[model samples]
Target: MKNESDIISLRLLDQTDVVDDFMEWSLDENVSNFFTRGTFLTKKDAKRYITKFIVTHPWFRAICLNGKPIGYICVSPDVGSDRFKGEIGYVLSSKYWGKGIATKAVKMVAATIFVEWPHLVRLEGMVNIDNIRSQRVLEKAGFTREGVLRKYYIFKRKLSDLVMFSLLSTDQLT
Candidate 1:
């Protein structure tokens, strides 16, 4: 495990308590905009989906601060192809925005990957073109913007472009 900081602590989403709160987050508009889902429209659905992810994904976390759940951080394999490598996604309580929580959480996860996983050559992230805050967070986490992917993702019913960013294991800034 990496050193725990005063502002954030990351742990696997293995507890029922974390999954329970994850339901509330799923409904919050600000939190769900970037990660849209009709499957988690109800609390029961949210619980089921989150539980499945916790059980299957190796790097899902309940991002907390001051012992309270504030958000989630995930590093998972990209869908469709291996050429894209892996990517990360996160959602934080709006109250925590502008306080550097997302950036800190991402940096911690990135460092953990470099230190613990020998096969990880690189990790990437995709931020919707309109999400400047997320873009800044990725930059602060030591990822460099690669380019834009046309019609990369669909959110809330419309196709959206995304900015791709990545960090290589050899990048000393980490």
Candidate 2:
């Protein structure tokens, strides 16, 4: 029997078939609770999002299990003088929570991102302080909990504290 990690894979998010799978998590308030964006309300909205953002994103990928997309992961690199660092983010279907799939996907990104972007030295992940599950995902993926950023930025229309985590190019993926 294949374990979750064994079947987990990542791929570009440009395919047409992913729209429905994308909706599974994209529409779930539980999944979008900590995201900067609000939950998508319809397939038309979800498709627009995929076309406008995911398709154009430089480092975004669909998190697949047994060849089906169940979520997504991406690294947004800072431009110009801050180009050495990138912020990593991910979202998985709630059905797969607590199964280590997110950690595996994060580890997969950490293992290859530096190589893919040779200039990148740091991969950062920020989580809402209230989102303990996300914090654990980063920790399990080998990120170091740097510190809390008080009132870091407005999240979902409110000032929110964020826990910052990072994994450097020299760091080993756990």
Candidate 3:
């Protein structure tokens, strides 16, 4: 029998092909509550967001199961001198939470990101202090908790603390 991790995969987010599936999680308040962006109101808006942001993103992929998008993951590299590091982020449909899909996807990224961007030595993940589930995903994926940044930034109009986590290319992936 195939395990969830065995079937999980990542692929580029297609602007026109997965709008409805994208909206499944993008519009769900439970899924978008901790997201940096607001929930998209319509399919057109979702598609527009996909076209304008996701398609152009340097490293963004749809988290897939059985060849369909169930969530998304991305890594944003800093420009200029800080280009050696990148920040990772991911979101999953609420129905898929607790199934280990997020961790699998993150592990997949950890496994390949260094080769894909050889200059990158570090992959970081910053999670809102309140977002324990996401923090757990990073932990399970072999990220080391670096500590919390107090009053890191404003989230949803309120100042939020963020827990910083990182995995170095030299570190062994879980």
Best by TM-score: 3
Ranking by lDDT: 3, 2, 1
Better of 1 and 3 by lDDT: 3
Residue 163 shift from truth in candidate 2, angstroms: 0.2
Listed in order, each prediction's TM-score against the native is: 0.86, 0.93, 0.94
Per-residue accuracy of model 3 over 83-136 as CA lDDT, tens digit each: 999999999988888888999899999999999999999899999999999999
lDDT agreement of model 1 with the native: 0.77
Clashes of 1: 0
Candidate 3's C-alpha runs over 4 A off are 1-6
In candidate 2, what residue range of length 10 has the lowest lDDT sum? Answer: 1-10
- Model 1 Cα lDDT, one tens digit per residue, 44-151: 666677667666887788788876677789888655564346778888876678888899899988887867666667788889898899999999888999999999
TM-score winner between candidates 1 and 3: 3
- List of clashing residue pairs for candidate 2: none
Enumerate clash totals for all models, in the order shown. 0, 0, 0
Ranking 1 against 2 by TM-score, winner: 2
Whole-model Cα lDDT of every candidate shown, in order: 0.77, 0.87, 0.90
Clashing pairs in 3: none
